[model samples]
Target: MMSEEKSALTQTERTFGRRQIQAGHALMMLISRAIPHPIGEVWAAVTDPDRLEQYVGRPEGDLRRGGTYELPDGTRGDILRCDPPRMLTLSVQRPGGHSAELELHLTAEDSRTRIDLKYASVRKGFVLIDAASGEWAAGPGWEFFLDSLSDFLNGENPEEPLGIIGWRTFEGEQLGLYQARNAEWEKVKADWDHEHEATPGPS
Candidate 1:
């Protein structure tokens, strides 16, 4: 699991073992994080379109069950479930792929909140994302947004990213973060994912 920091964890308890998936079983991702914010604040940060746009993307939808949502980068989904300041589920479809079932769970404390995110798909190959960031290739994407949420809670609204791929791409281009991130990704996949390539998983 990714802790408070956006950086990766060396070892994470996983639900899927290292193995190649054919056409039957889907790859899955599960992660949990604790944020130092109230449940209401945390919920708004993730579900509120405007606030969500501050990190993920601009969303246009009623945000109710069965409502459709399209993120800024063309990623689309249906709101499968929405529970105030607590839980949410989405049928997310990436830019050029089939839909995946996504779930989010939250619990609140007096001054903090915990979130568990899950994503699963049988039709989509999570290779790219997995190659990009091992666990988050299909994740709640806290690494990309946790800091943004922190910024929002602190009232320092950011002007870039929020859900715009171009903005993040520009930053990676400008700061060379992509090269570093990809380099590390390559190493991680080689050390970890490579073993699963030829080993067929449950079909």
Candidate 2:
């Protein structure tokens, strides 16, 4: 059962929802993970700028509902909703007129906390299939962040805090972990695709 337990530790769920937008079909990606920490602690780690700097990049600006924030990487966004230690929603404005909505929901699971992240965006001139299949970058990227968050919570320092972009910077055991996680994600994606293909779509 050791293998099963290991799989449980890295378990993640991804779903895509389609909706019509002015440009075309909009896709929403939802990813969830369970962290072995209290809800309050997880909330602080995700929302507080100081703690966020440990795993995610440090963001600057008024971090509250109706305020604006800018990441170190030059990405800017507005804080659409902030429910404090529970939910946060943002409208991310990227370059080239690209925009996206991100939502984070935290639920308490006994002594652990469950984090649900939703990312929705509309491709200006792309079809649903085009946007859906290229999810390798987004999916594995978020998984890395969540994994880094878990490491930080457990008092472990991550060698690469920037996730997939800095893949080549990691070495030895850290590099091995990143490669292993990528392989795991590939298996998860394959299984998800197979099951969905056999199932019926919404009527």
Candidate 3:
């Protein structure tokens, strides 16, 4: 299933990137979501290494300016910048050494806090269309993350994965492409339903 999803996403990405085949630019935007936790609590959740692992990806070692972190699979990267309870910029060591800056801005409203995450992917040249389409394709991941983070911060787990599935198969015929995408969506939705059933309910 994973292989199939990956293949579909690759094809969709190729179609999405055809225009930017030469030089694809980076993506930048601010995404905001409300967390049930208080501002101070949310602040700690992002700054504290132990707390961060529960919501975001796990941390490798101490989290501070100039510190390094690794993904669960041991993909390592450095903490380019760290601002207490607020902003964080990391240099991800990927195939092309892509740099990503994650900033968490906290603001208090009523009894809850609004966390604004600005994700900036730094690449060369112009890639707005590709970036926008990729974002639309990857919407499920962000949606899952927001939902899971809300549960985690409120002292619970949704018991679900945070990711997306994009399907695409083009046969040089527009109608064929549409039908293929529709079929793929059905398969993806069914798979997601199965995964959700296997997962335990919220606490």
Index of the highest-lDDT prediction = 2
Worst 10 residues of 2 by lDDT: 124-133
- Residue lDDT tens for model 2, 8-64: 435887665554433456666677888889999988888888887777778899888
Candidate 1 versus truth, CA RMSD in Å, comes to 6.2
CA deviation > 4 Å runs, candidate 1: 1-25, 123-136, 139-142, 166-203
What are the lDDT figures for the candidates, one per model? Answer: 0.60, 0.70, 0.49
Residue 168, model 2: lDDT of 54
Alpha carbon lDDT of residue 59, candidate 2?
89
Better of 2 and 3 by lDDT: 2
Best-fitting candidate, scored by TM-score = 2
lDDT digits (tens) for residues 1-203 of candidate 1: 55422243322222333212222356655556677888888888788777776666778876777789887777787887887878898877776666567777889866988776666677544523444433334332433455467678778876666565432344433224333434444455465556666777799
For model 2, the stretches where C-alpha displacement exceeds 4 angstroms are: 1-10, 19-25, 95-97, 124-136, 163-165, 168-203
Off by over 4 Å in 3: 1-25, 94-97, 123-140, 158-203
TM-score of 2: 0.72
What RMSD, rounded to one decimal, does every model reach?
Answer: 6.2, 5.4, 15.9
The TM-scores, one per candidate, come to: 0.66, 0.72, 0.53
